[model samples]
Target chain A: QQQVKQSPQSLIVQKGGISIINCAYENTAFDYFPWYQQFPGKGPALLIAIRPDVSEKKEGRFTISFNKSAKQFSLHIMDSQPGDSATYFCAAESGGSNYKLTFGKGTLLTVNP
Target chain B: EAEVAQSPRYKITEKSQAVAFWCDPISGHATLYWYRQILGQGPELLVQFQDESVVDDSQLPKDRFSAERLKGVDSTLKIQPAELGDSAMYLCASSQELGQPQHFGDGTRLSIL
Candidate 1:
């Protein structure tokens, strides 16, 4: 039923600019939200994650802003670089179901240098 | 620096052929996951295992798909008489335990003609 929905199937940003992707989830049971980055021909890599208890979590230039009340979350990449060109996926996990992750379709990001 | 390992980075076979993929989780990780990712879509879990036992396989197509993890370490997923619709990327991930972060392998791309 597409528990998690992501927006802007594709994105383009200039180097050093900020890049953002948004996601919304329908299941209130979800407590853990994570973002993953995938390069072509490779697997998705864990980027950043946040729990319902935290409104925001930052790692290096990647940040995840989560709003539990709204059932929404977003990823922000500060000073996006060419190296950041890849696909990003947002996922939600509910502990009640053994932490099975439900993922959003994905957003293809391109950073032009 | 440890990572999950998957064999046969890419596989191409005709429809109705039997195909198999293998995965080896990181050391000390007890939880394993197998996911299928269609082109331009997020990965969906096909099965999950904890210590050689399946914790979930609700999304798995039991009619043609089967997976097993023996000795609580490596796992194998097999599909018999594969269909054209089965062409996709097969990803394997592992975690230390329930609720922990998962690490993914490069994945095996399967193309069924």
Candidate 2:
């Protein structure tokens, strides 16, 4: 109930290929889902977020797919590039909370040219 | 680019030593947070402050950790008699209002010897 399990502890994708990271959360109280990107030695920053009301949200080359019934969400990266190589984290937050973000262990993504 | 600011990008201390970190949130942000991220894991929330009062500190160690935001603009996190297991990245984030997206700082990488 407290953990958001993410898959593929590490991922390797060829340039221009698609990179997908999945996360499954057990808490149905989580109303907001967000993905964060963190570079080496840097803090994780919000990349994109979506509410449960929306099935999907697209921001530039990144997209978030939410499944209410499945209690799962994913982050999709298109045209993977070396610059995009970084650790991606999937997070969840319950409504009415001021600033609490429960995050997954994280997925290390490497895009090879 | 008004971003959350953190001090002493890195710190190396020995066991039983004391360590401190500072954070200046973005202007007009009323909510602030402190998070600890161990290597190979996602960030974990240690505390949350609303303006000058602490709204939550459920996960805070309490034994050796304490935080405060006197003016609600700048905050500090302190640890006394630090242990080796305490070595990790300390992150600070702030949001404009409740339930809003938070902006994070680069974070302080602490290595306890």
Candidate 3:
């Protein structure tokens, strides 16, 4: 069973537009949500993250909107640029000793110049 | 900025051959993870370690795959008699402790012929 599900396997947006990716989880135990960005031939890097306590979190041009009641979260990029084109993955982790992460299938975002 | 390190950025081997990958987590990090990412998919955890002890390895294919963190700092993952299906990217990540955000390495891309 897939613990996390992400929509839109791929997306394309014009530069200066807003790009959005959505994710949902079935495990209610998960409390921490993180988003990662990866480029071709490179490993994934942390982009932004949010907790159940907060409804949203933003860093620079990246933003993560979380809905604890719906067990969902979404990533939004404002003023998207070609440099922001990459694969994005959403992952969740529960509290306690186990820090293992459950990841979504990922979305390939392309920002047109 | 500190980052996770992985060796052998790319490897090409024939089926049934033995292959090994290495990883070094960021200094002062206490948790380490090994993940496998197939094309068009998100990374899946293969094993996790806390300090020098293994915390989780249920998803690891014990019949042909093995991993160890002998010194609790650097880790090695070995696959014997590799199969064509084993062609994927192996990623290593580390965190300061359980439940913390993880930092990832560039990963080793393995191609089985």
> Which candidate number has the best TM-score?
1
lDDT of 2 by residue, B1-113 (tens): 89999999999999999999999999999999999999999999999988999988999999999999998889999999899999999999999976899889999999999
The TM-score between candidate 3 and the true structure equals 0.98
Runs in model 3 with CA error above 4 Å?
none
Q: State the DockQ of every prediction.
A: 0.95, 0.81, 0.88
TM score of chain A per candidate: 0.98, 0.95, 0.97
Winner by lDDT between candidate 3 and candidate 1: 1
By descending lDDT, how would the candidates be arranged?
Answer: 1, 3, 2
User: How much RMSD separates candidate 3 from the native structure?
Assistant: 0.8
Clashing pairs in 1: none
Question: Residue A43, candidate 3: how far off, in angstroms?
Answer: 0.6
Candidate 2 chain B weakest ten by summed lDDT: B95-104
Candidate 3, residues A10-103, lDDT tens digits: the string is 9999999999999999999888999999999999999999989999899999999999889999999999999999999999998653878999
Alpha-carbon TM-score of each model against the true structure: 0.99, 0.98, 0.98
Candidate 1 - CAPRI tier? high
User: Please, what is the whole-model Cα lDDT of each candidate in the order they appear?
Assistant: 0.96, 0.93, 0.95
Model 2 C-alpha lDDT per residue in residues A1-113, reported as the tens digit of each score: 45799988999999999999999998888888989999998888899999999999999999999999999999999999999999999999986555478999999999998
On the 0 to 100 scale, the lDDT of residue A106 in model 3 is 96
- Worst 10-residue lDDT window for candidate 3 chain B reads B95-104
Determine which window of 10 residues in candidate 2 chain A has minimal summed lDDT: A92-101
